[model samples]
Target chain A: MLGHLPYALAAWLILWGLYGIVTSRNLIHLVICLAVLQTSTYLILLAIGYKAGAVAPIYADMPAGTVAVDPVVQALMLTDIVVEATVVALLLAIAVQAHERGGSLDPARLCALKG
Target chain B: MLAPWPVALPLVAAAFLAGLGDKLPRRLADAIAIGAAAITALCCALLLAGPPVVYWFGGIQPRSGTAIGIDFAIDANGAGLAVLSSLLILAALFFSLKYFDKPAHMFQVLLLVFLAGLCGFSLTGDLFDLFVFFEVMSAAAFGLCAYKSREVGPLQGAINFAVTNTAGAFITLSGIALLYSRTGALNLSHMHRMIAGHDDSLVLAAAALVCTGFLVKAAIVPFQFWLADAHAAAPTPACIVFSGAMVEAGLYAVARLQGALFGLPQLRTPLLAAGVATCLVGAVMCFAQRHLKRLLAFSTIAHAGVILCGIAVLEPGGLSGAGLYVVGHGLVKAALFLCAGMLLHRLQSIDELALHGRGREVPWVGVLFALGGLLLAGAPPTAMFFGDGAIHHALEAHPIARFAVTVASIATGAAVLRACGRIFLGLGPREPDAPGGGEQDEEPETEAAPIPWSMWVPAAFLLALAIGSAWLPREHAGSAAARMLDAHSWATQVLDRAQPAMPSPPPEEPLAKGLAHAALTVGLAIALALLTLFRKRLPEILRGPVRAVWNPLAGSLRALHTGAVGDQVAWLTLGVAALGASLVFS
Candidate 1:
């Protein structure tokens, strides 16, 4: 049960973030919730990259013999982090515009384009 | 290296255009955007002359027969899609020359960026790379949708689009991570080679999540509320690309991923159901719309559903037919949207009811508009006609789908015909005293501003190509379909050279039955149109019953699309959960 703790936490985090998005009244909160949901992916990647008794993957005349955690997953997570930043920045900008134009960040008030 | 150019050239040009900024002469910016798009189109065309070209980025070829490097494996279908996107982008740029009030360099840059995203998504073989390119494409689209951010409507629409699609991207990323956790492979071919013989729950979960992500982007029902708003709010040129190529890319990703990795057997039933539901919903909502752009957007949703059905059949005939349909529909839809854009720019209103009899003066555009409508409706000698036939042939084994096929075909045709009648034929009320008269237009009604040649040429050119493809001999069409459906060859070339030679090809179906199917569909469409146009003339008893049945249903459907960001996010999450449930149960 303890070994599964990370997975449990990741799943909970994603669902919690989704709940925040569902109930949040402000656009800023929604963007932050999105970032939180995206962090679950980072956590999963880090978990997959882990190895018991593994050393850093830098091979510059390091320890004579050492197992290494997967470096590729780390690279992927880094890239994902960058993408998350870009997405959040853009969403925040749009949210700011929404607040300015609609006079409210509440989605309930933003119905100018509805059927 | 050369294979990557189609995807890279546009990005390079986009950066250069951004640097040049608004100070760059308007014509120079136009020239740069168009030139880059043309070259990229040329590159994709050149790739078709050879076998699949596989490129390894950063000179990091797979080590020890394991795919550790990012690979771009371009098959014939991929090449075909790349050419379609770039060509459409080219046409969009050409039409935008005089469309916008001012020359916005950012618009040109965004178009190039969008082109690159489509090209990259088409050619890349890495799952994560596909995700990256998908984001790039979608982000660019969000920008273009809100390009006129000074307007409240476009900004709201863009927010809804961005928020929902971001959630979709996260779901897709999580799926990729899940698959990586299980198989430790990001390259689709490598993943396939590793997981081919297994039927694990983890794999099912990943597939479902990935598929849901793409389906959301494709605007499949239950996840499609964003499309109509986004298309209606976006500039016409951008709408052309969004409707013409972006949604198709989403469908292509779904099929490509399933074909390369999961082989399409487990998820067929659910996908087929989704396809039918999407088709029915889109068609129903399409006719209910008053805005021309929204109507076109819904039609795109319907066509996406039809293509999904063809794809869900998961046979050579179905896949080939889907390819032809996508190409044909893309061109037809682009022309229609361009014509709609012309009307919007010139008349300043897209309300079909208000625009009745207003377009009769532009006879040439009227002709193009009529042809576009006919092509979309699967008229004879249109590529869609034969493509629809192919889809019918594929559904031969699924008897239950006959009703779905017939209703979808008729509804799709009727939607276009309905728009044509309201816009051009003046079939609706002839209220000459309508408040928003066409005479008090944005441009001077005194001079009757001459329509730009740039706009008409692209619409006509695309219309001719869409219909002209029908003239190809039957044998050529058959061979092209066979080549596209040669999945064994695609797998070997893209995944592993050591795989065995492809088995014998499936027997080709005759086109005669398809023609019969088209005839029945078009006839039903005409009947439906007449019924709609003369509904007021019907007996009071029948009219009352019809309204009773439809009014409440359409009301609820519209209510579901509340245009609130939070509601859209909720639906997206619900969609993901439903997909998960389907994976587990199936």
Candidate 2:
């Protein structure tokens, strides 16, 4: 049960973010919630790459018999990190623009185009 | 290998353009973008002429006979998509010269990067690589959507799009992570092989999440609120990219991944149901929209639903029809948007009522708009007619699906035709629609702006491509379909290369039925247009029931899209969960 903690934690983080988004009023908070959700994915990736008793995945020629964690997930996590940074930056920029132009970042008032 | 050139060249060019932002002349920047797009299109054409090419990254081979390393795999369908995207990119750039007033070096760079991302996403065989390319494409799209950052509408649209799509992407990444944990392979084919016999809940959940992400981008129902706002607020050239290829790329990801990786038939029922719902909602909303770009965006959603129906058939004929439909739809939609752009540029308004009889002076413009409407109606001798006919053939056995497709095709066609009649043929009231309804000021006035040859040329070129394919020998389409449907051949070629067998093209309807279907579709569109033109004159009894049914449905649909970012995000989350539950239980 304890070993499954990462899965539960990742899921909780995702759900927490969803809840935050559903209730959030402003663009900045919504973006922050999205970042929180993205962090869950990173956690999941790290969990997938984790090994119970493994050394860092490098060829130092020091541990011939030692096990190594999967490097692929780490690499994927790195990519995800870069993507998250970009998305957050872009989202923040849009939020700032929204605040400046629309006079508010409240999701309720950002009704520029609707049905 | 040449397989990577389609992706590499555009990246290099985009970097150069972005780096040289103000230093480079605007014309030079535009020329470089056009040249890169043309070369990419040529590369895609050359690739389609040959067999599938799979280029493994970093010289990594299969480890002890297990597939590893990322591969740039370009099959005929992938090549076709790449070609379509690059061609549309080229057209969009060509049109941008006159469409944008000043130097837009950053815009050109974002467009090229978006082009590279699209080509890469279509051709990549690795799930993670697909994710990266999706991010690249989407990031550029966010910037492009809010290119005019001073405007509240565009900024709001971009913000809503960015937040929602980012959430969706994170969900997709989570799905990828789940799949990786379940099966330690990122290569699509290898993962497919690994998960062949597994019927685990985890796998189903992951598939659902991945599909949900693409579905959001594809603007499927419940996940589609961002699309109209984004498209309507975006610049015309950017709208071309959004509607023409970007949305289709999302659907392509869903099709390529599901058809190639999971190979599950359980998806058909859910896909069919969601597709039908999407079709109805798109057509109904399209009918209600007064904004020209919003109307086009809704129709894009509707066509995406139609394509989904074709894909849901889970057969060779369906896949082939889907491929052809995407190509046809992209070309026609881009042309239609370009024409709309011209109207907006000239009159400073895209409101149908305001543009009434306005196009009468430009006979060629009217003809082009009418032709585009006919093409949208699936008129024969256009690729859309053949593609729609193929989808009908695929769904012949499923009566409900067949009926849905018929209604959707006719209704969507009717909506576009109605626009053409009102705006071009002056079929309706000459009075402005809902005076001061906040439609006129959507775009700034550009009076007496001469429609340049550059603007109309790309529209004409895309229109010809959409229609000219219909005049081609049926065998070309047939062969392309056959190639797209033969997943076994694709898998073997990329994996083992032992079997070189190719499947023959599926049988299609005789020319007479296709002609009849085309006629019926056109007739429905005309009838709908006439009805709309004389709606106020209709008998009270006849209009009462129609209004009763339509008012409630439209009201509910509109209420769901409250234009709030939080509301949209909640809906997206619900959609993801709903999709996962349906896939798991079904």
Candidate 3:
């Protein structure tokens, strides 16, 4: 139960980040909040896959062929991290361009694009 | 070996084109895109000829009924989508040859990546892998949306698209994590096998979250505002792909998930309600649009809602209807958008009211646009007629829902007729005296060239396919439906046998129902539209109390959308917390 604390904490961080993203008026802050949310999700995913008393996945002193935490979730988390980074970078670029053109990062002024 | 190439080929082509496409000749880059899509289409055709195959990566295998390796599986549905994607890409590329200016290579590269991501999204067997592909597709779409950075609308549209879509991705990923925690498997089929009868509310919450991501992508109601703006702001060829094929990826995800994960009875009601609301909202929104491209965008959303209704039914016929609608709508919408692009190129504006009576300037384009409009209205000898008819007929088994779908289809048809009337029939502000006066009016200073055959050929081919698919014999249609059903294994087989052994229905059933509905709805719509067309009556109708009631609702909704970043974030955050709470509680 104590070991699962990290997973709960990660989930909480995700919620908090989501709160920040929703309440913040700045585009940069929203992007940052999204990144934080993404990080928290990845952490939660990785934490869920961890097993008690399990050594590092790769270690010389570990029991030979002993079962460890599932590797699938770890791989998924890593891929997700890469995906998140790419998405965040792209979002940041778009936000920067929007700011340059509109002179305001407030989404209220961005209505120039809507139907 | 051929299995993975359908996805990998395009990815490689995308990378190569991005790196060196700009330096290369425009023709060469276009050729590469066409070649890659052609190969992918061929691969899909070959796959369709065989039974479903699962290709495992890294040599991992299922142990104790758990899938430990990544898998890409191809069944009838996937093959059908592959074909649809390839065909749309081919058409977009064909049209882009003359439509675009410089930087042709970058456009082609992004197109290839978009294709690759779509294929990956359709074929991947793991939930997390689906997320990966979803991100790939969304990111590529965002890039394509902003590719025309010289334009302010495209830049702003791309920003809004990125934020909304990114938030959606996060929600989807969170759902995946939760599902993984409950089931301890990533493979979708394995998860299905494991969770089939398990009454875990957590899975339901995850399903809702996962579905929200696709819903946003699909541009269903409440999430549809972004679609019109994005579609209107995108480059013509990009709009073709965006409206034509990209949004379908979202519907595809929802359909696939419903088929695999949420087959339980409890989930069907909410799904159907959402589908119904989307259909109604989309249809109404279509009537409210003034821009040709934006009207098509809303119409596309309406049809997507119809397809969702088909999916909500969860019957074999319903699934087949949805499949048919997806393919049919993709082709017809692409053609419509491509035609709209040509019209816009010639006229430099998208307002139908502004471009009234300009159709005759480009005679062939005018003719094609009219035909495309007919198809959009689901006239006989179009695939949408059969697909939509089947959905309406299937809904007949549920008496209460049938009226709603019938009304929605009628509204959809009427919306198309309204646009067609304005663009093709109404008198314009500046009527050109000559048959070829469009060229003179458009660019009087420069010599006008003939509309390119490259553009006409693809649009004609797609229209032909749409007509031909509709004209296919009922038995052949049944066989195609059978292929979709065959994927469900025993349930499908049992249902097949249990189906009533009455004499086969005539091929004209769908045609008859569609025509009847179209006539009734179009007649009513025209009557109402005619009344509104008289400006004096419009003002009288809008006077005093009527105006008072309408203003506040519009103002409130408009206020809700007041371009405030905080408000958008607040909604996003509220949605996330609501979803997260649902996950935890339900």
Candidate 4:
């Protein structure tokens, strides 16, 4: 079964990240928790495309028909990373403004929209 | 053939507008956004006019049988959605010309990017592209929700929206990774081919994760906590698009993926259950609201649930019914939000209690608001009426579903009607202690002035479409629904370069049944609304009994929607786990 270790690692990261997000008091920490959660996807994508005993996908220096890790998933992972960066940046910016306006970053204290 | 333009055009325009921010005149920026949306809509309409197309980017043909590059597998349904989104964007931009003040071209830029994302999400043949575009839409939406960030309310709303959705997106990406690892395919058609008759745990889990991600976007129950906050705080123009098209995109992706990759009957139960739960829950919470935007937001959730029900039936009649319902419901929801915006602009308040009888000042908006409620209640010959007929015919095999749909429709409609009575007619007793009701002071987006025709005209235009686009005729709707679900033919066309043949649509939904259901819906909506409006006039004995029974149920139902990000995320995770359990075991 292609070594379930990576899957376990990804699952653990996901759980840990969710736990952080659920328990975090501050908005910055929540955003970071979200980033941590996003990191699990990166790991999963890389693990899926990983090829033990295979070379990198840089075919420029490799012999023809050599086994290499999947370039497609790597490409997807790259795009996903870019997207995560944008998301984290945007969330962080909002957190900053929210802190500025409310003088606090604790979501519990940000009681404007809650029940 | 025209697939890419619908997406690419808006993106390029957005980027251009972003670059020219504040340097260009405001009027020019508005023109650019409006022009771009119009052209993109035209392009989508053109795509709809043709046979299904598979336009590969950079001309990377998969003639050798492996999908090497991204492609757009455009069908009538996808093109129809893209056209709808583009048109809504056009309407929003038109309405916003006089709404915002002291803004750079930022709002226009965000809107155009949002349009691009919506188009891309609608037409893309690849799952990864769907995620990318979904992110594009979400990112732009977060920006729009936070554009001014002048108020604490908007900031709180934006933060919750960003975190929860980004989390959902990551889950979806992981799902994509799981599926890709199993099938070695990214293109949906190719994935379908690779997954031939496979219903393994991996597939189930991936399906659960992916659908969970989309349900978040669709703002289904549990994942729906962020929507009311976002919609309530977002600008009126942005709210129109969010409620009208963006949230619905989530449901579309779920259906599209189901048709393409996993059309197993096992998954149907979970989908239907989720749809019904959202429908009932949204209705209950909608009826218990005091904030007009939040009320409309919850109503959006309720109708989205109804649309999901149609898709869950897994038939052409139901699919097409949902399609027409989406057009009818989404447009009416947008019009209603516009009415709310009008109230916000003219009276500078949206609190149900605070704005009591204030709507008389803006009689047109009040009339439009009440009319939107009537359409929502399934007014005869309206688009929703046809949609309801189709759905009822489809769900005829499931009688309990019919009752559920009926109850949900009545509750949501009556909620709107009751609000109309209170805000416009001053008929209801003002109660202030309801949960999350009438909580925020809306910052006026424009100067103190008469409400402009620019705003009301667009709402009226959208309402006209909502009321009458049923003229689209049942046969054509049936055909479009058939094509939308014809996975085999769609795969053959997209991957093998085969000319697609149209399939026959199901028979028309029985009009007699639709009329009966429609009358019941409207009559109950009116009666319930009037009851709530004049409930105090009821004898003390009846009133006491009603409150004793109703207050606790409504309060408990409303309490579950705590509007906290942590609780929402927790519920999302639990929902995903539950969805996976049902898909895996059932």
Candidate 5:
């Protein structure tokens, strides 16, 4: 029961973020929603690495053969975070450019790409 | 050493080019990127011919049947794709030399990074590593899509592309996390061995998430709305990459994963259904578009569907056919985009009606476009015909996929042929206000062009290479499929350092039937072109029923591909949920 909470929270975060993206009116909001959507994965990665009553992965002062949470997923999460940062930065830049091109911030108003 | 070089070389070049910044001369940047790509392609080609090799990073080989470090599992199939990606990057860089006006400083850097990502994605043995490379490629693509940031269309395209793709990526990561929690391994071979005969809920969900995510990347139905807009907004050089290599890379990943990790029987039906739907929808959309680039983009989607159908069959022959088809379709598609770019360069517009009769100025481009259209429809003696033939031979038991492939070929080919007839030969009377005003005021690549040799040479070269792909050794491709499909040998090669021992490959299918199939499709494409161009002159009986069925469906498809992120995400959410539910029950 205790271990499942983090995963359930991760699921909730994903669904909430997706909902926000689907209902988002503004371009910046949509990008933020994307970021939020990505955050769920980070949580899942961290949750996969987490251990109950376990020490951090660092071993500087720890005794020999100490129990530690898995470190690989933490590393994966860090790389994933970096990826999310770059994607969010790119999307935000595009949003700003879209606004500067005399286009409205509302996605409904942006019809330059329609069939 | 060779395995890592294909990925490492372009990355180093990208870093050096990025550091060069504004001080870097455009020609020098182009030369460096092209050099890196050429070397990468050479390394991949060598790898494809040589024995299978597994290169471990930092000398940290697998211990106790599992890996702790990343590895590149270089095989004929992976290396073949890497080679394709590098060649496309080379072609795109060559085209960009004269295609972009004093562009932003990061253009060459991003292209190199994108190539590096594709190579890494193609070669990586770890699931997590694939996601990282996917991000690297997609980030570069998003930036490239909005190269002209001063325009609204490009920005919208970039945003929608980035958002939908990121959502897909996030789902994939969650799936990876679930798989990790179950087996505690990121290595594909390790995971394959861990769950040898299990079809548990967690694994099923992971497979679904992974499949659907890559399916989104593959631009399958309900997740295909972003592709056309992205292509429409991107520069012509970038369009060559987007259609030629990037989307195909998506299919490659899906096929790789299904063979490596998930070989579930239930997975095939949904995948086949999606592929057929995308095939029909994309072909219909391709025919309906007045935007030339959009038309080509939809054709790519349709071809991707055919390739996906081949892969979903999960047979050695099916995979081999899909592999050859990818190379042929990619080269022909690249050539067609180049021709379109040429027309846009010299004529300043890509709208069918706007450019009508204006192409008389560039007769060579028209010739190339027409040839590409014919080859794309599966004309004989080209790689496409051989590949299409192989796939048809594989699908003898399944008629739906065969029918879809043929119809899509005829539809896309006819659409391109019609555009050619109107634009190049001035066959049909022009409608002044026909819908799909289609990207008016496109900024041309160059103001001064008798069509530079730099531009036309690459298109002619790609087309020639595609034509010559007919002679590719069938045994090599067959052996590649043999090595790829047998998970036991693949895992053994990676985990146990065992010599690779694959079963004898499936027998090669004869090409005679495929030749007839190609001839028929090409003839149908030509006839369809003539009919569409002169449809007003045709009697109502010949055209009326077709219009009744096509107009309503095309209208809805267009409405669905509204280029709106919210609607696209809504479709994605619904599709993924449905896919996941099916997986759970299966």
Candidate 6:
């Protein structure tokens, strides 16, 4: 059970980040919270696929690959990270523009686009 | 030969278009999108004509290996969805030509990418590949959602959509990881074969996780906050794509996964419960909204919930009903969104009051909106009515389930009726002075010339498709349903034997019942139209309190959008945690 500590920690971080996102009023803080939550999900994924004492897929110390973390999860995580980075960047740019146009980053004031 | 190109071409075109989109002429960019879609549609039609062909990437055998390479399986189901998607994208592209002002290239690029994602999602056989396509679709959608970055609503909506959907993608990836660990395969068909014989708790957990991820994408009850904002904030063309095609992809994933992986009886009850809850919540929410686009968004959620009910039955008829509903709703909802866009372009507001009398000005749009509404409400001749009826019949064996479907149908009908009453019927308080020929003449020349055919054509085409697909032969319809039911299941096998004996008209049966239903539906439609004509003098009792209750509910739902970045994150996190826990526990 202790071996799964990292996975548990990741879960905790996700929950913590969610709490921050829900309670925080600041747009930047919300973005940061989302980033944190996303990172925790990645960590949970990586931890789930982890095999104790296994070397990373790239190392010479891997003992001819007797055991290694599932490479599929690694590849998926890598792709996911790239996707996340792009999304965050685009979102921040949008947020910056919204701030400039609306004169405030407060979500309450961004009602110009409401249904 | 043409099978693989439909999915592959759009992907390649998207990359090329995105790179040269800004550098190229607007006409070239638009041509790139429309041309790619036209070719895709042609390819789908060709595939439909041919036998179902399964193209294994790198010649990997299916259901026997680790699914190292991706597979594109072209069944009737895939072909139908592919054709629908292609036509819808083509329509959206046509609309974009007139709707967008500048950055035509960016618009085209995003549109192609979105199409690529949808096509890839529909065709992929590998579960992991589905996740990848979902990500591509979602990321492109986020980009398009915020494409109009100068506006706060678009920005906030995009951010909310990104945060939630990205997390959804991650959870799905995690579910894939768990499934891989348990089954050692990435292919859906392979996994389905393995999972049926195994009862490991981990498989259930993985299914829950994956379904949660999909539910978020599908905008099911609790995870629906981002949809209204994103759909409402997006440009009209993007809105058409978002509502018409994109949401269906999520439901498609759900149906595909349920049929392929968790067809177990134990899973059916919980799924049905979720579907019921989603329908009730979504329908009630739809009734409360005032903003036309937002109302459409909530209505989408309600309809999706109804689709979920069909999915929960896990029968061929139910699956077929769900499939038809997805296609039908895609067309009708897209048309409604585009109509709303047309109204907004001319009237400058989505407020029901603002759009009150303007319906009289744009008779064609008004008629189309009414048609779209009737279709959504499950009136006959339109596809949703058939789909809804099929769902009702499919669930008849399960009383609780039947009751749920009935309530959802009624709610859906009432919501549509209410919206029509408010928008077309003039039951709501009139705008003190509407713009055309009124005190608002001081406003800039808001009434543009009637919308061009490019904008109207796609919407009209979709309407025609919705009506046509509803009239498809029962055998052809039965086959699509059978494919969805996983023919190997005992439930399906029994249902199959009973199907021929059932009342679905023998092959020799004339088109009389269909035509009669159409006539009855049209008569109801005309009566509603007449009501709309005399709505102003109707007693206040019918309209007043109903609007009063609906306004606050809609307002409160909108008010939940505190615009706080944190709140959005919080909801996303909760959603992720719930998904993760479900996956872990199952």
Per-model lDDT: 0.79, 0.82, 0.69, 0.85, 0.85, 0.69
Q: Considering the two chains of model 6, state its CAPRI-style docking category.
A: medium
- Report how closely model 3 matches the true complex, as a DockQ value: 0.48
What is candidate 6's local distance difference test score? 0.69
Pick by DockQ: 3 or 6, better one:
6
Give per-residue lDDT, candidate 3, residue B150.
60
For candidate 5, write residues B1-586 as lDDT tens digits: 7888987899999898888856777667777778988998999999988888999999999998979999998887788888888888788888887776675447778888898888999999999999999988998899899987777777888888888999998999899999998889999989888877887888989888877677788898878988988887788888888898888889998888888776676777887788888889999999988878889999999999999888878888888888999989989999999998888887878888788888898989999999999998989667677778888888788899889988889999999999999999999888766555334445665674678887899999999989988888877887787677777888989999998665676787766667678889999999999988888998899688989987888888777776778899999999888888888985
Query: Per-prediction DockQ scores?
Result: 0.53, 0.67, 0.48, 0.68, 0.68, 0.52
Backbone clashes in each candidate structure, one number apiece?
Answer: 0, 0, 6, 0, 0, 4
Tens-digit lDDT string for candidate 1 (B58-77): 87777655888888887667
**Candidate 2 residue-wise lDDT, B71-186, digit = tens:** 88777778888989999989989888777777877888888899999999999988999999999999999999999887888888887788788888889999999999988988
Candidates sorted on lDDT, descending: 5, 4, 2, 1, 3, 6
TM-score order of candidates, top first: 5, 4, 2, 1, 3, 6
| Candidate 3 Cα errors over 4 Å, as ranges | A1-11, A60-63, A112-115, B58-61, B397-401, B428-450, B472-511, B521-586
Q: Place model 5 in a CAPRI quality band.
A: medium
Clashes counted in candidate 3 amount to 6
- Residue A90 of model 1 has an lDDT of 89
iRMSD computed for candidate 4: 1.9
Q: Between candidates 1 and 2, which one is better according to TM-score?
A: 2
Supply fnat for every model shown. 0.60, 0.79, 0.54, 0.71, 0.76, 0.75
Candidate 6 - chain A - TM: 0.82
User: Is candidate 4 or 6 superior in lDDT?
Assistant: 4
| Span of ten consecutive residues with least summed lDDT in model 2 chain B | B436-445
